[model samples]
Target: MYVAVKGGEKAIDSAHDWMAEERRGDPDVAELSVPQIREQLSLAVNRVMAEGSLYDPDLAALAIKQARGDMIEAIFLIRAYRTTLPRFGASLPVETTEMACDRRISATFKDVPGGQVLGPTFDYTHRLLDFALEAEGLEAPEREAGEAAHPRMPRVTEFLNQEGLIQTEPRPDVDTAPRDLTREPLELPAGRPLRLQALSRGDEGFVLSMAYSTQRGYAKNHPFVGELRIGTVPVEVEIPELGFAVEVGEVVLTECETVNQFTGSKLEPAQFTRGYGLVFGQSERKAISMALVDRALRWKELGEDDKGAPAQDEEFVLYHCDNIQATGFLEHIKLPHYVDFQSELELVRRLRRETEGRVQQEAAE
Candidate 1:
């Protein structure tokens, strides 16, 4: 058993004070504002929101500032703060089909109903570091805004569904509320909804690693990006008095849908299966990684042969996915374990003494 050391209150307080001063840096330097972080460090804010399981940009930005740009730390702050917030009524699910897409692309098809809109992507940009950015107040060059090509672009999966080339997704009851792991404890052998929620809020690095493993032939389910889209979708809530759903607000989301290969079986026909990923904000990498991992987890459900892969192991992935939990357990080792160490030390010494006594007795004999 680990016991905390006493009489460190003053030292701890002093350390905290020093940390605060360090976080602020030089007095002459301009302080970073929450708004600036929210707008400028949008990706960091997005990641914090995704991992923290909170959607507020301002709060996430504030956490980022407080954590001194440490993403995992920021996520921890946001998650801690989120627990104190009062619960509002659950909002109706946003319709991704009706999304006002900013960036939409498909690797499976060259051309679709709406053309591939490469909106605000670094995909084609050179990796060279721009020295101009090192200088302050440099304005980014802007191009003329184009008119919207399509109001509601058709999903790539729909095209496959039309031709019966892919497995059809069974729509769940719209009114039925999905189980929230935040409110209730996570139970083993979780349903897709629960698993998805966990994965969506999971550590990006962990999910990415699991996804990468599948790609590297650990659990090779040949996957192709059916479509990846980043856009704002309207969030609606059913008004009790009005008895109708009204649009409350909108949230930016990155959605990735993967098409994976499945062999034909005696009972089931050979068709491309779908793996879905939806995360808050413009996180293509996280979203894509999530999709791949989601597909890998569904191997048992999909009736595929289990290859004993880590990604396929639900307990292993789910238990280790949360960085906060993982970090907390790992960081706990720094705490004083004096009693435990002392016990082990005594046992070792006793064993050595016993061995020495036995050797002396044998010599005497």
Candidate 2:
């Protein structure tokens, strides 16, 4: 016999109270403002936006605050909020060639058309934590006046395309709309669009691990960062009544293009293949990882032999990539299973008694 545990509601309420108190640690200290998080923690905000598939920085900041700095939880909050909003219309695909690039680099070519602009990056920064940041009333560095005009930068892939060195993406039918993974159930044999969508919103750490595995010779494809660009692009929406697309807003995006080597098949000629990644903001790591994973998943389409790598398995990679889903299942273990445990305990005891009785009977015989 087992008594059902009670007071779950009360316990949950108390836990929430404690959590709230802890989240507001040291009342005497000034609370972190949403604007500060939005501006100062811009990278965190960008990650939340990228994973949540929502672009509102203010909302992302609020989600971060509500989540108490847990980025996955913040992404969950933003994703939940996004589901409630009404969809007005789909935006026309923004042209990345016309992007107002703040940062652009290529591993393939050092001397590109627009020149490499090493805009705000931590690539060369020492990993030392600045104690000066902890000091109160520290003045921010003064900004230099007069911004330089950004010329239209050509894509690095285009240069390779001139020589017919890389495989071209299949042109989709104009009438066919891309599948929405959120609204529709994910079916097997997913297309590039669906796979790319899943990867874009997938957990950064998960995708990073997959990419790292490939780099460690799990399924080495000889990847080269053809181009990585970060900038703002205009979003336009086609109004049915207006008969023309209108600029709705501008969104910051990080786009990565990866050039991968592929051996020639019996039917196809040897050529460099392309993997593309485009994310919500200045999320280069996620974008690069996404690109690598994208290429790995294209093994079948590219007529390459499946090397049984985790990154190459579309079903396995996409299914387990969501941190929220993983966390929920993992954390569910904390829930009470009193009845189930009691049954298991009784079963074990009965089995032990039966074994003892059988041994005694055999000894008597």
Model 1 pairs in collision = none
Q: Point out where model 1 deviates above 4 Å.
A: 1-6, 147-150, 363-365
lDDT of 2 at 333: 82
Model 2 over residues 1-365: C-alpha lDDT tens digits? Answer: 12323566667889999999988889998899999999999999999999998999999999999899999999999989999999877898889999999999999998999999888899999999999888888788775663456789999999998988988777788688889886776788899999998999899999999999999988789899999999999999999999999998999999999999988798778999988899998999999999999999999988899999999999999888878778789888888888899999999999999999999999999
| Segments of candidate 2 deviating more than 4 angstroms | 1-6, 142-148
TM-score of 1: 0.95
lDDT string for model 1 (1-365, tens) is 12333447767988899989989999899999999999989999999999999999999999999998889999999989989999879888888999999899999999998878888888999999989887999887776666554467899889999989999888898778789988888899898999999999999999999999999998899999999999999999989999999998999999999999998677779999989899999999999999999999998888888899999999999999999999999998898898999999999999999999999999999
Q: Poorest 10 consecutive residues of model 1 by lDDT?
A: 1-10
- Residue pairs in clash, model 2: none
Model 1 misses residue 52 by how many Å?
0.5
lDDT of 1 at 134: 77
Q: Give the deviation of candidate 2 from the true structure as CA RMSD.
A: 2.1
